[model samples]
Target: MSVKEVPEEYLSGYAEILAEVGRTGRRLTRDEVEGRRALGEQAAESGHGLRALVIRHLAATRVAWPRTTSPESVLAAVEQAIDAFAGGYERAQRLAVRKEEAARREFIDDLLYGRSDPGRLAQRAERFGLRLAHAHAVAVAAGPEPYDDTHPVTRSVEAALLSRFGDRRILLTTKDGRLICVVPADQEEVVRYFAKQAHAATDGGRAAIGRPHPGAGGVVRSYEEALNALDLADRIGLDDPVLHAADLLVFPVLARDREAMADLVDSALGPLQQARGGAQPLLDTLHAYFDAGCVAAQAARTLRLSVRALTYRLERIHRLTGSDPTDPQHRYMLQTAAIGARLLDWPAKEL
Candidate 1:
C-alpha cells in the first residue's frame, strides 16, 4: 500500500502517544502499550500489513523537508526513528523515577524538620500517601557507620517499614547518617521489631523509638524525642537494640537545665577532686558501689578489688567528700551527683 493509504486516525493516535512521551518523559503504561498493540493487530486484520503501515505513518509524520523517495530507504529511516524513540523512552523512564524519589525525600525531610506549616505539611503528606492526622511516633536507626538514602541498610529498613505500614501511613527516609521513620502510634512493637531486624542486618547497629504523639506537629516532637533518646542510650551505655524515649525520659529532663546540673555536680562531688589519683577512679568506684546497691562486697567483686581495699576507698571517699555512701541521705545526694556528672560529662566540658 502507498504511504497515503494509511488511516489518519491510527497515525494521529500514535503521534499523540509519542508526543506525550516526549513532553513528560514518562514510560507508557501497560494499558496504553496494549492499546497500541491492539491497533497494530486491527491494521493487520484490515488487509494492511502492520510494519508497512507503521513505516508509512512514520514517513507521513517526518519533518517537512524530504530526503529520500525509495521504499527501502523509507523503511530504513523509519526503523532508525523507532530505535531512537526506544532509547529516549528508556532514558526518560529512568529520569522520571529519579525525580520522583528526589521529591519524596524532600517531603520527608521537610516534615521531620518542621520546615513547613502543619496544615501544608498535612496536605503534602496526604499527597505523598501518608496519613498524618492520626497518632504517630518517630523511630530512628543508626548503623556503625554513616548512611544516606543510597545505603543498603537504609533501603532495607525502608522496605521493611513499608511492608509493615503499607506505604500510605508510614514515612521513611534517611538523613544525617540515620534512617528515620514515622509510623502509626499503635505499631510501636512492629517498629521495634523492624528496628531489631535492621540492626541485625547492619551487624550490631541500634535504633531509638520515641513515645507516640498525636497529629502532624507530634511527628516533629517525636523525632526530637527519638534523637534525645538515642543520645541518652549512648551516654548511659545501654545495650538494647531498640531504645524507647519513655525509658530515658529522666536523662532528657535532667539535661534540660544545664546550669542546675552543673551546680549539683560541683557541690555534691567537687571534694573528690583532691583524691590521690584522678577523680575517674573514685567516680568509677562510687558508680560500681551504687550499682551494687551500696553493698561493699558486691561492689568490690565487680571492681575486682579486695573487700579491705573497697572499704579503704569508701573511707577515703567519705574523708574527702564527706558524703558517706553507707548513709541513705548522703547516698542520695552522691547518686544524684554521679548521674548529673554522667549526663553533663562534667569536668570534661560544660555540655
Candidate 2:
C-alpha cells in the first residue's frame, strides 16, 4: 500500500481518449482502435496485470474500440498508463518488504545482544506460536542458507514456519538476512521445522544450514558461538542437520561454577592488597588486561598506572597465585573467575 497512486495525467488521458472516440454521436471505427487495444492487452499480461484492462474499463460500454478513436494513438496511451500503474504496485510491494526486513533484523540483534525486553520477544513468540523451552539451543543458520541481506523469501518462509506449528515455541532473529531460531532442548521437531524453512527459503544460495549460538545471558559470546557454529560446520562438517553451541563447551575445566568461581577469586587476593589487596583489585586488573586482550600496555593505561608499575603488579599476582600472568590459559582462568567474583560480590579463594 506504500505505492504511489496512478498519475493524474494518466487518468485524465484515459477519459480524454474515451471522449474523443465517442464524439460525433458515433463510436470510433474498429480500424481506429484495434491495434491500440492489443497493445494494452499485451502490457497488462507482461506486467502481471492480466485482468487490468477489464477492471479499468468495467463501466464503459463495450460496443467496440477504434470506432471513433485512432488505434495507434489509443494503444500508445494504454501501454504507457498501464506500465505506470504496474510500477506503483511494484514499488509498494518493495516498501512493505523493506519494513518487514528491518523488523526481522531487530529481532535477531536483540537475541544476540540481549538488548530487547521480554514483552516484545513474547509477542513474537506468541505470534509464531513458539514454545520456548526452559533450556534452549539458539543458533544462527547461514551459508547456502535461504537469503542474502536483502531477501523476501526469508520472511515468507518464516511466516510459513511460524504458522506451521501452532502450539510450539519458536523465537527468531534475522541478521544479515539469515535466521537465528531458538528452540527448546526437547523440541527436535521444531529444529527440523526451522531447517526445512531455511532450506526452502535460501533457494538458489549455498546449501542452507545454521551455526550454534551462545547460552542465555552473556549474549555477546552467545552470538559469537552461533557464528562459530556456522563457520565450523562449513569448515569441519561436524554438525548433523544443524549445528549448536554445546559443541564448543568441550573443556571440562572451563565449565562454570558460578558460586565456586566467586569464592576462589575472593580468597586468593583479599589479603594481598598493595593496589587493592589480594583478590578483588588484582582480579579487576587482570580482567581488564584480558578484556583488552592481554595487551599489558593498554591494561596499564586503563589501570591508570605507569607501564613499569603495572608490570610490577602483574609479577606480584604471578607470585601470589603461583601462575604466570602472561600465559593465555592462566589469563582465561583469572578473567573468568574475576567476572564471577565481581558479579557475585564474593572474595577470591586462596590458591
Q: Which model scores highest in TM-score?
A: 1
lDDT of 1: 0.74
The numbered model that scores best in lDDT is 1
lDDT (tens digit, per residue) of candidate 2 on 180-203 = 666665665776667666655665
What count of clashes does model 1 give? Answer: 0
lDDT scores for all predictions? 0.74, 0.54
Per-residue lDDT of 15 in model 2? 58
lDDT of 2 at 18: 51
Q: TM-score, each model?
A: 0.72, 0.42
Error of 1 at 160 (Å): 3.8
Name the TM-score of candidate 2.
0.42
**What ranges in model 2 sit over 4 Å off?**
1-17, 20-54, 57-69, 124-136, 141-179, 184-186, 192-244, 247-351
Model 2: number of clashes? Answer: 47
RMSD of 2: 13.5
61-82: candidate 1 lDDT, tens digit per residue: 5643233334344344344444
